[model samples]
Target: MTTETRPPAAPPRVDTSRRTRAPLHLGWWLAAAVIGLTLLNIGSVVVRSPNLDWSVVWEYFLSTDVLAGLARTVELTAIAMACGIVGGVILAVMRLSPVPVVSWAAKSYVWFFRGTPLLVHILFWYNLAALVPAIAVEIPFGPTLFEVDTNDLITPLLAAVIALGLNEAAYMAEVVRGGLLSVDPGQTEAAKALGMTHRQTLRRVVVPQALRVVIPPTGNQVISMLKASALVSVTSTPELLYSVQVIYNNNFKTIPLLVVASAWYLIVTSVLYVVQHHLERRFSRGTGRG
Candidate 1:
């Protein structure tokens, strides 16, 4: 029998008439246009203002005094953050402890520190010498075992470090505790079942997993800590803002000096943002948020 070849069937047509176009809201376009124009106008005014003195800004931006102040700011940030991270971990552990008194004490510490402003902490540490002329170590109701002049121990730099570090610890403890809590309860239970001690399980399994949750906020705190280092200028700690203040105080070029300080802050914060993004991506790898 002869086989008949059938003609190829025609391809189906797309339903173009039923296709939907995304909505175009004229109000959104108009609002965007208005905002863009407003920003351009403000920028033009700032860029053209004669009193801003770009020359003065450039002249002192990398001056010796300013560089020294920038170095001080970086040093303080590193040291303070280190202290805060260590103290925060300890406080977070204490806060999570089963012992009622330990948890309550940690809570009280967080409450007191968080309730007080960082500026107050700085001032308090700076003026500690006034409150107590000497720092003493001794038996509670007995003779002093050791004593030292408060001023000798608590210099301006030391005072700034103590203030910034302790204040950061209060905030960081909450961040760490949140991270710890995000960890799955089953992970802890499994580790314990495998003969791991509580501390061992926490250090190995829980903390490693918790890092993914902990890192983003910790990075933000680092950037904030860098900016907050400016507050140390109150105690004449010679950080970035204080250094510029000295320049403006002598030359009376207040706005330009402030611009220089702001420029440095922006540059450093930008770098930190990049680092934080990379870290978040690295930690979020399998989770798909990356």
Candidate 2:
């Protein structure tokens, strides 16, 4: 057999040189064309629009009043978000409580706040003094500890924060509850088996894990809160949009001031977008491929 061995069997051919065309995707081509046209339209508008006063926008973009208003916006967003996060966590805990009354109260809270329009909430909070002129800390049928005038407490800034924070708490509660539900029940059981108390398990084990699921929506809510803070302008709160309104009211430069406000909002939201993306990637670690 060795003496009669033929030349090595010919290698199978792959024909690497011959190129095959990729299958055409009409949907992809249509999407590309649409996007291209949209970009072209935006370019044309930026280049050729009749009445975009770039000079005025540039001049007033960093003016003192606008800066002050922007600062106020940031302050309101931070305070409101802090309040929302704390309150929401409590509400979420209440919703998940073993007691029926606690669960009912939490559900009722979410139902009422989520059912109402945010604008209405804002107006209601801004005008709350009209209904109750004073808020007090007092024992029922006993002496008052302290009292404060509602008007003194509800400054424009405070009103905006209160409205946004309280309203945001309802939504945050649902987000937190959903996140909590996503965690495995077996983990809770295991914690209990390990002799962990309910509060200890929740604080040390549950909430930490739940936060990964909750963060993305929380970021979105933060962005929404940032924009919603502008609605305070209706109450003349002197945030970014209100600052622009003040300028336009004085100089009759409506469009430019709006553009300045728009620019600032776009800038802030873009930064937040980047921050959210990195945070999500961080939290997703060990949960995905190498």
For this target, which candidate reaches the highest TM-score against the unseen true structure? 1
The whole-model lDDT of each prediction reads 0.94, 0.90
Q: What lDDT tens digits, residue by residue, belong to model 2 across residues 71-169?
A: 999888989999999899999989999999999999999999999888888888889899999999999999999999999988877888888999999
Error of 2 at 66 (Å): 1.4
How many Å off is the CA of 177 in candidate 2? 0.6
TM-score of each: 0.88, 0.86
Please report the candidate that would top lDDT against the real structure. 1
In model 1, the clashing pairs are none
Model 1, 87-180: lDDT tens per residue?
Answer: 9999999999999999999999999999988999999999999899999999988999999999999999999999999999988999999999
Q: Compared to the true structure, candidate 1 yields what TM-score?
A: 0.88
Q: Show the lowest summed lDDT stretch of 10 residues, model 2.
A: 281-290
